[model samples]
Target: MNANVENQSPLLRNALEFAKANWWMFLLGGILYILFGILALARPASALLALAVVFACFLLVDGIFSAVRALGAKGAEGRWWVFFAGLVSILIGLYALFGPVNTVLLFVYVVAFQAILFGVSIFMFGVSIRKAVSGEWMLYLTGVLSVLFGLLLLWAPGIGGLSVSLMVGAWALVIGILRVVFAFRVRSLVRNT
Candidate 1:
């Protein structure tokens, strides 16, 4: 159900326009995520340090993109959550890059925290935009998967690098593909409106 352009709240309207404008980038991000996931799963036996670097780079780029989305969005409910999530992501990424905790447990906690925080934020955002976006369920599903993945990690924190890679990689692949699908929906919504 497309809202009349005149009927849309400025915030929602602005957000939709932003999504339409950046749909390509959003899709690209999803593709990149899928590739990264494939890489992780293919080499789950990679060293802890290597895995750490992969995760760190992922967090950094993801954080930057989240921040961009948050900044670009205006007047939407729960909007600040994205911004706050972005800040947390950047902090976690930087910590992963710099702080040498030298323990897999520490990495597990950080990674779990990042995923859970981001999932919650995106879930809220998706709910908030339900009336505006046809594919909000995709966002909700992505969030649910992320939260589940994080909880699984929290439940079993002592897993090996291969296990962690498989779990995270699989989740990323699913979420990324969902986002790519959702991006097309958004583009269609933009066109219909």
Candidate 2:
């Protein structure tokens, strides 16, 4: 029993070390999301159009990947959903790419739906983290923030869409930056630990 406790302690300590190293990356991502929201709000119409094109490009790439994966699929019959999702994503992308500015509603819907998913993911992570540490309230706070933001997005689809797009853009920008920062920070961890 003493040996087991000693073994578990290092594992838990290492896990906490990992989380500490990564937490700043997530916070940076949140900051970026806030900035994106600001940008989208600045020019909703143009941003919407730009976003649609970006999504279209992603869908086209995703479709190509999905089709390739589908072709190589083995006995996994459920692989059809991947192909189907890829097709639908491609079609939606094309529609948004060519459709008028009024098609911005699609963008709005995507933002709201993404918010809900993000909220749920955060909430689940928070709950799980609560079990890991006695005073890990930050996760809970983050989860609450995520859920609230998601709900707010759902409540106002148009504004939510604009907000979410900006937020997500900012988030990606921050996350990307943080990842670069952390990459440098982890050099010692890579070498020593």
Candidate 3:
């Protein structure tokens, strides 16, 4: 058994080792989501629009890359999805870039929908983990909170641009902080192993 464990791929071993050694990263992610919620409450409109523009840019870039890859494909599977995605991305990007200022609500709706989905997923996870650690309650709380936040944004899709910007900024800041912390935890465990 010991030899068999030792023979496992380093990547798999590393992942397990990291998870065992650092659960704090997951905790930080929860905290980050909470912080984002707070920010979303403060300035939803601006935050959402900025987020949308950024997403649009990403989509454009991805589309260009996908189009190129698809064109160069020798026999790769799912080349059509990639090509289609690329086209969609470019079109979305162009709309975001040149669309009227009044179109900001479109992005807000997207963000809200995402938040609701995340919330539902988290809530489900919390319910599933109700019998696990005593602290699974936190997951449930975070999930509920995420859902509420998303719903609120959806409720008033016409929220001002500044508000949306602030919401997005807060979300980015919190998520970025959490990701950095999580990465550190993973790094530390891998180093120790």
TM-score for each of the candidates:
0.91, 0.45, 0.46
Instruction: Residues 37-68, candidate 3: write the lDDT tens digits.
Output: 46555656545555566655644664565466
lDDT string, candidate 2, 70-93, tens digits: 444433333354456456556665
lDDT of 3: 0.53
**Where is the poorest 10-residue window by lDDT in model 3?**
125-134
lDDT for each residue of candidate 1 in 1-193, tens digit (9 for 90 to 100) = 4656568677777766767777776787688779778877888876465777777878888888878887877765676888788888888888999888577888888878887997898798787777777768888988888888888899999987778878777877887898789888877776776
Return the candidate ranking by lDDT, descending: 1, 3, 2
In Å, residue 123's CA in model 3 sits off its true spot by 1.0
Of 1 and 2, which scores higher on lDDT?
Answer: 1
Candidate-wise lDDT, in order: 0.79, 0.48, 0.53
What is the lDDT, from 0 to 100, of the residue 19 in candidate 3?
36
Which candidate achieves the best lDDT against the true structure?
Answer: 1
Worst 10 residues of 1 by lDDT: 1-10
- For model 3 the local lDDT of residue 173 reads 54
Question: By summed lDDT, which 10 consecutive residues of candidate 2 come out lowest?
Answer: 1-10
